[model samples]
Target: MAASACATGLRGSLVSSFHGTWGTSMMGEDYPALIQSVPRYVRVGPPVRSPPCMKNVNEGKGIFAPAVVVTRNIIGKKRFNQLRGKAIALHSQVITEFCKAIGADGKQRQGLIRLAKKNGERLGFLA
Candidate 1:
């Protein structure tokens, strides 16, 4: 009888200690209320979709479009445009002189330009 009473007392102390540490009843019916008392987090603004300055590299429509876009980004837009125009004019002049030296006609020069454009596209410059 004494051993049985001691066992009951030990079980009661364990239950009381558990209730004190957890701040809950023996059946845990207050768990939902405890969880509801916790603070919730909320976002302040809309989520980010993309970067602010995502320039489209496909805006330029030529065999050297990608190079032009990269150079434009490195240099200012105004300076890049000026340099691009001068380079294009120089390229045309050089091509015209080479065609004259080789006795090639306008049609042959145009075909060569088309071939270079095709090769550039295949190499993913148009991408």
Candidate 2:
């Protein structure tokens, strides 16, 4: 009975403390004024333009982008891009064949792609 009364008293005190002027003093009356003093919109300068050399730079794309970029640097851009396109087509064909062999559907194929992406990220290929 004493324990129950103590619990009730504690609960009541907690409730009262929550409902009381606890946080009001901490915030003070200038809280709203301080909030209103802050400017909503900030002025930004004009967009910066990239240099000519940086402008035409191809950073590559997809999960194999980093490797593609390295290969692109090794081989010339035009030739590398052509080869990359053909290689991508061949890779897609191979993946399609493998999927067919395993009886994997579109969803399974997507899962495989995601798994490959995850593996690539783990292997620092995405970096």
Candidate 3:
């Protein structure tokens, strides 16, 4: 089982394959641009609403409707550490946009996420 047979791809044997050999381990060296060139971020929106159940949460001494927000990000360990600042900056931008749209005083962060306001306990706005 000479390694040359695998290199030439004539017999398609494991002896000459790239799967497990120190011959080309440097090929594993990750280049940021090369990795970034690959499309990574895949966004899948929430499923169709199936008559959402009413969940109660306590707020200000009263039970209020709860809105759930869940996000999943696929970032490798090194990339996670590297993108911390970028992630925070994007979050800050979103916060700024929300504040500008709602005309909030930018004091209460909790108040910003849930921007639902009631008008005479009948119709409401959630944005």
Candidate 4:
């Protein structure tokens, strides 16, 4: 019982001390405006062109603006397959270049691929 009481008091003090460390200035208007004014540090990819059907619906919806904008990728099976094809092509090119750089023959390249697959399984990446 005494040990439990000591634990409760310690936890209460920790919570109170944490609460005390948060300053009221952090909630000030200037602080929020400053934070908002600072641009976000994240990768910005080019927006995909809208489809023909969507283009007709989007006409005259807003005033013409000349600023750059970034958007997330489309979420659909068609888009996924397109991106996957590109990724696979890139992967194949990289592996082919690496094998060529090491002067590996066809048989040696096959052996290397098998070894890589085995290692991936051992590392739980291909499991």
Candidate 5:
């Protein structure tokens, strides 16, 4: 049900009571054998529902190796001699700065955000 139309008052109390009674038995065994028990109904919330924030998320977080992104960058002009330094000239820095510029570091992605904000300024759709 939509948040505004959620069952309230009697319906909520009724549901709470119904579920409360099902979790126990006079013989001390869990009443519902499984979540799909005949009398127990499973209700999935609306598709747009947000789950509780979970931990250990990998994407959108910089909790990954720097090597994968920085190793490909060229440090200097070189056709014969390759002068490379991991700390001083690893390609990861370019990617890191680029990400920082766009605010992927999460403090603020203002550069791209500003560009996007002004996208319509020069367009025929300018407001």
Candidate 6:
């Protein structure tokens, strides 16, 4: 399904350039007169039609639901010291940024709101 969609987009774009050029050149005088003309529909290639299942869905803004996890492995048991200072510091930086945004007001807060909205319902902040 994904492959078909990609091929459709790429093929349409490739042929569209020729289609536009053909239309413009066809309007000019002193074009080759004896050229055997094929039907426009036949010569221009078949139209690209998406699968019926995707007709009502907007491909660009589709929603995704995250799966719930029931079990998680202990981080340090298998790989000792693998996730020590570096992991902690990375998490701390993320927490600090969240705290700053939470504490901010007006202009600063708007940036956070915009990010949340851009993420759509993924963050569960907006329905």
Instruction: Report the candidate with higher lDDT, 2 versus 5.
Output: 2
Best by TM-score: 2
Ranking by TM-score: 2, 1, 4, 3, 6, 5
Model 5, 1-127: lDDT tens digits are 5654665554766654333343354433544455346554545676666788743233223422233224333343241124333432444456457876765864444454455334423331111
**CA lDDT, every model vs. true structure:** 0.69, 0.69, 0.47, 0.56, 0.42, 0.48
Record all residue pairs in model 3 with backbone atoms less than 3 Å apart, i.e. clashing. Answer: 6-16
RMSD of 3: 22.3
Deviation from native of the Cα of residue 61 in model 4, angstroms: 43
- Backbone clashes in model 1, listed as residue pairs: none
TM for every model, in the order presented, reads 0.38, 0.38, 0.25, 0.31, 0.17, 0.20
Give stretches of model 2 more than 4 Å off: 1-70, 121-127
Candidate 2's displacement at residue 55, Å, is 15
Q: Evaluate model 3: give its TM-score.
A: 0.25
- Return the TM-score for candidate 1, rounded to 2 decimals: 0.38
Q: What's the residue-level lDDT of 84 in candidate 4?
A: 50
Which lDDT tens digits does candidate 6 get at residues 1-127?
A: 9999999999888874454466667765435552445454554667888777622222223343221111113334235234434554565566557758678545655565555445544532121
> Cα RMSD (Å) between model 4 and the true structure?
20.3
Give the per-residue lDDT digits (tens) of candidate 1, residues 25-101.
64378778877887767446898587687544444665666775687788988897687567656766777788899
Which tens-of-lDDT digit does each residue in 1-127 have in candidate 4?
9999999999988774334334655765578888788889753798767676522233222332111011112355466546656755665567778999989888877776677545534443321
lDDT of 2 by residue, 1-127 (tens): 9999999999988764344385886687888998799897754688777776633222343466677568777888789768856765676677778999989999988777677646655554443
Flag the better candidate by TM-score, 4 or 6. Answer: 4
**CA RMSD of each candidate after superposition:** 15.4, 12.4, 22.3, 20.3, 19.4, 25.2
Candidate 4 residues lying further than 4 Å off, grouped into runs, are: 1-74, 111-127
